[model samples]
Target: MSIENTLSEIRDINLNYLMLAQQMIREDKPSAIFRLGISKDIANLIDSLSNSQLTKLANAQMMLARFRFDDCSILNMLTSYNKDSALTNAHAVMLMANQPVEAIA
Candidate 1:
């Protein structure tokens, strides 16, 4: 895909992720922190952002859509022998982000 298209897709994903994080914070702050793997301070910062701020951040096209495991060994440990389990976990993340899991793969 063209770079512009890729960037647009990233922006859309970022917006959706931010919006879901915002809702999770409002509904269940602790759960949001746990699920997002974010510190309370970061969660509070996310919670404090207005929708406009979120939109601006999304438009910046620098937000991440998924976490990258730092260690290859960790990734292997998590998904080496159980592909189904890995897929289920990924689907759960999509659900949490309010995205259709099927749309992902």
Candidate 2:
């Protein structure tokens, strides 16, 4: 609806994502890296961040997390309704697994 509302929602999502990521990383570093599609350095940074730091970062206007896929085909395959939903989803996952993880510049 309003810009302010949208931004607030983004901040909420960011906070939740960060919290979940921290938990995931703590539970299983390798699995978290793969699931989050983040580099080891980034994962370490996220794991080390204090709650206050996470809150401050989440308060920023822009979203902190993003979709892993930029490919139209992957997006389409994931979103489109298909009779073979399991197979289609598996295919999407396979494609995403090959996509590069985010690396710091």
Error of 2 at 98 (Å): 1.2
Candidate 2 lDDT over residue span 1-105, tens digit each: 999999999999999999999999999999999999999999999999999999998998988888989999999999999999999999998899999998755
lDDT of 1 by residue, 65-100 (tens): 565454454556555667597675665455444522
The TM-score between candidate 1 and the true structure equals 0.68
In model 2, what is the error at residue 7, expressed in angstroms?
A: 1.8
Q: Residue 92 CA error for candidate 2 (Å)?
A: 0.9
Query: TM-scores of all models?
Result: 0.68, 0.90
Candidate 2 deviant stretches above 4 angstroms: none
State which candidate has the highest TM-score.
2
